[model samples]
Target: MTTRWALLSVWDKTGLVEFARGLVELGWKLLSTGGTARVLEEAGLPVTHVQEVTGFPEILDGRVKTLHPRIHAGILARRTPEHLKQLEELGIGTIDLVAVNLYPFRETVARPGVTTEEAIDTIDIGGPAMVRAAAKNHEYVTVIVNPSRYSQVLAQLRERGEVDLFTRRMLAAEAFAHTAAYDAAIALYWQREIYGREHLPSFFFLVGEKIQDLRYGENPHQRAAFYRLPGMGSGTLAGSLKLQGKELSYNNLMDLDAAWNLVREFHDPAVAIIKHTNPCGVALGETPAIAYCKALQADPVSAFGGIVGCNRPVDKEMAQEMVKIFLEAVIAPFFTPEALEVLKAKPQVRLVAAGEGQGEGLSWQVRPVSGGFLVQEPDVYDFAEQELKVVTQRKPTEEELKDLLFAWKVVKHVKSNAIVVAKDGVTLGVGAGQMNRVGAARIALEQAKEKARGAILASDAFFPFADTVEEAAKAGITAIIQPGGSIRDEESIACANKYGLAMVFTGVRHFRH
Candidate 1:
């Protein structure tokens, strides 16, 4: 019987000793390098160092350990007679399997204040070369890069005495993907280092690990899965910890993200009720319970089955109030033990803990178009007091200014042509994704009804005409806030003055389409 040779080299030594032992038990010679060999030897398994096969000592601080022609030829040579004869003439043995994983380049760079030299040292050259060579010769050599596949590969070898061609091909594909993502991480890190985070690179590589496979996409027929970006911090929805309830769906994730982002805008105890990626109602109060009550009161009908987000921890008081309604999900920084017990009354509701603090690291907002993607900076800009210009003759009162700022924050998260009517730090009505600005205003005004009187209105963009202003004035709106860039902005200002209403221009447009 011919002696089967398997080469193993990996930075992550997970399952390495046991895997090498399995190969040794299966009558296979183990060839490894440096740390991997040390681990196998300590496990009392017979293993040959790569340097012994290459007949050359490892040099360059172990960077050139597995780059020799002996290692490459052994793994890449075919099983054909001609290839075997060439290997025989070169005194080289054919390696039937190669298991290699690259260095921790991503993790190293993700560390706070990581130096360039530290990051550069972590770039694995010989490892990727070995993995790719073995993957390319998958017809002859089986390649494994992921440690999770060790058990399955060992099982296959134990049962059949060899890995099948189909399994080898799949392993090769995975090995290539592993190397690709590794390279992408290195490329992105260097790009960001050389040209600042604001500079857009010619080639953008997005690498993600599959977090879960959803039951369905937005609809039942469509397929979908959730992927977490590499090195993502715990502040995002992807990093949220699920405390209870059924698995999150695609739509649930979407709505949860919207609710979380909206609620994060306020410093006070805030709550946002979201439906279909739009805020049905939002408010800030002394406590999360009060905020939830006010936000729910804004639109009780729309709040039904909606997702809820809170900036502060969910306490027993808040949980008690939340359980009174039918909420699909509630996400907060944390949940008290008493609160969890109270929330247990509604076991179906999803409880997620999105960790506190600002979203760590920079991220681009990405949207898919027909052929490619639209990448832009997130709308994290908040208007300063200096940016506010009272265009109308009447300046907003102190109370109206506070509500206008609150309404402005809420409108920024709404879809384009958005309108929000808010009073006393609570959104009374929201009109989003309308075709016309006046149409959106009318919808919001209609929703507010009597509550619209003395409430402040916020528009996501400049009014194209005076129609929205006239509509707001008729609704007894006391103040209006919008970006003032339209050619007909003066007309809207004149109408505000005529109605004795205060209108402020933020000098910024937040279109959330």
Candidate 2:
């Protein structure tokens, strides 16, 4: 009877000895290359080196180790009569199982002072080739790229003498996914090096590792999971440490990300209170405690059961104020010891810490549609004062400009059609995701009520008509700021002038969906 064969060549040598021993116990022959062969031999297991099988010594400082036809033909051969006759003629044994994990090219490049040569040296060429070959011939072979599957594969092999077709298909899918991600990392490095920073690649290769399987998606009945790109730095929720509280649900993470991104926009101490992935209130203050208070006071009714994010560390004062309401979570750079103790008072509230490291340079945002997907760079533009074009006859006062800039930042975070009313760097009311601009304006002004008299309005997009301006003027809006690009810009400007309201055209629209 012909002996079954398994080949192993891995950069990560996790569970290699025990897994090989299991295969040996099942009356299988083990063939390994380089360090894997040495480790198996050291573990007192009989191992055949690949050079012995291929009759070729490793050359070119180990770069030309496993690219020989002997290695690939063994993994790729179909178990047909003609193929078996040829394999017997050449004395080549069919490799029934292949366990391989590629080199750490992604990690090597992510290092702080890594050179281009070092990164190129770490890219594993032969490993991916073997994996793809085995995966393509999965009907007759089994492939293992992840170490976590070793025990399961070993159990199935021991029970049935061969891997089942269902498991082999699943393993093939995983192997393909692994190779795709590896290629994407390599492509990203070369593209960034060749194209430089300013240009975006026309083709996008996106791959992510599953970080979590959530309880549900947006709702309890829907299934959901979360995946994070490798080396997505500490600034994002993937790297955030959950210091305390219950497991984060899908909605909690979404709202946390929204609040965290909004708070990071301000240089000073800032607070962003969010609900359902929209900023209900946002404010900047001298301290986090003051910021939280003002943000919550913006719309106390909407602040209930919301997520809070701070640009600065959360102190005892901020924690005390936060626990007073039923908040879902709080995220910040850090939290004081006293603040942590106070926050623990509410066992259900999630506390997360965003560490110092942030993702490098420009990043892409992806969304799934019905047929395919959409990918674009994140909207990180920060418009300066010089970029503003005052369309109204009356230019905004310096104090009003300060407040308008503050409201502009807050309005960008709100869903469109969005309108934000603010005064003194504190958001009074935010109307988000409305059907019409007039409806958004009415909601914001109505929420602000008496406070809207002195506050300035910030619209997310150009006003298509003068109806929104007329409504804002009736609510005592003193000034207006919007991306004034509509064809009817003159109509809105004329209305603003008629109402004696100072309006500034940013010439940049922020239409968040």
Candidate 3:
């Protein structure tokens, strides 16, 4: 009998028949259950029905298919003397390779109005057991979980007609990750279904499959990889289908995400120019043409090499104007024929279209630490006018209030302890990623240059000290909008009064940290 017993089961039946044929050619008996067996039998491949070996039919609507001892013993049995003797005595065949992938619970649950019964039906109990069995027996059995690993496994099998210890170890690691991510999706959905929310995992872990290895990380020396949860929504990458350009770097993804978010905030024809993950300029106009011009005029120097996003389609005139300046990325819902042609001429421009993206509304964000990831809800909300309190005696002018609201929206997405100064639908200046609020205020004032005078200021958080207010006063800032939560709110209010700056407390705070 062949020692290589290949157990195959998969929801995504990509390359399964071919892989099974290859295994059979190499003298490995294909052992499978359910749809896997049917697929192979239909394809006329030699497959041993798992029930013939286990002596039991699938029960509980296929939930108890591969959870038997006959299957696991073959996978989990040690290669040591006593284990080998016991396996031989029990007629337990040594299962060598397991090709398994779980059901698509994420998709089932994500569907509109999907009942809990339907979602539960899609969760496979047997799949996780098989995967974990193979992973636990990495010392003796080879496991293949992701189809992405098919080529490498095929290469190893073709080159030597067998999987090596090193390859088996890596495959086992991937198998665990596959099942973990599968379980996580189920856990999140289950909690959301029953408890109305998925609480933080006490001992949380996620296994993201590598989508693409980027050219470099934040810098050229460091390496980076784009990872994705199998069934979860793909972020900017899913929506952004790159037309033509060099591959995106780590920093490029950052800037593009920021650009996409800010531009999406407005429904009107709008343009948002982002540099280093912060909006340098944003404007809403009658058309994409007008929006681009207004955004460009906001701060032309800073807009250089920035990522530009628009809510409306890009037209030929807008594209022609765009060619006049250098940019890293241009993203829009659509682009007119002439506009695409114009941008096509500029091959270096990374153009992306969002019209064919995954869904109507999607929110996903990822953060990386030295060792792992930190993923959570995106900072998304609307600030109602009723939430505002007039901290200063004087009420803001209608125009000033509109500009204040604009500046306030821009300030939230900026880095922590950040401050933004804007007026009349234009960004006067932005100070982001600063340690202290006062320092950020000072930087914005300096960057604004002559434009600082009379521009409204918006802070992501309340001013801890009165110095920032004092600085804005010296810069001739006319109005301020911020969330008032500082312990020294009275002192800050006094300083705003002293400087004659029309300040308001927008009870809703937006800290990007």
lDDT top scorer: 1
For model 3, name the residue pairs that clash: none
Give the range where candidate 1 is weakest over 10 consecutive residues by summed lDDT.
Answer: 356-365
User: Each prediction's Cα lDDT score?
Assistant: 0.93, 0.92, 0.82
TM-score of each: 0.98, 0.91, 0.88
lDDT of the structure predicted as candidate 1: 0.93
Ranking by TM-score: 1, 2, 3
Counting only residues 3 or more apart in sequence or on different chains, how many pairs clash (N, Cα, C under 3 Å) in candidate 1? Answer: 0
For residues 324-395, write the lDDT of model 2, one tens digit per residue. 999889999889999999988998999999876664433777789999888777888887799999999999
Model 2 lDDT-worst window of ten = 355-364
Candidates' RMSD to native: 1.2, 2.6, 3.3
Q: 14-44 in candidate 1: lDDT tens per residue?
A: 9998898899989999999998898889999
| lDDT ranking of the models | 1, 2, 3
- Select the stronger candidate by TM-score from 1 and 2: 1
Strongest candidate by TM-score? 1
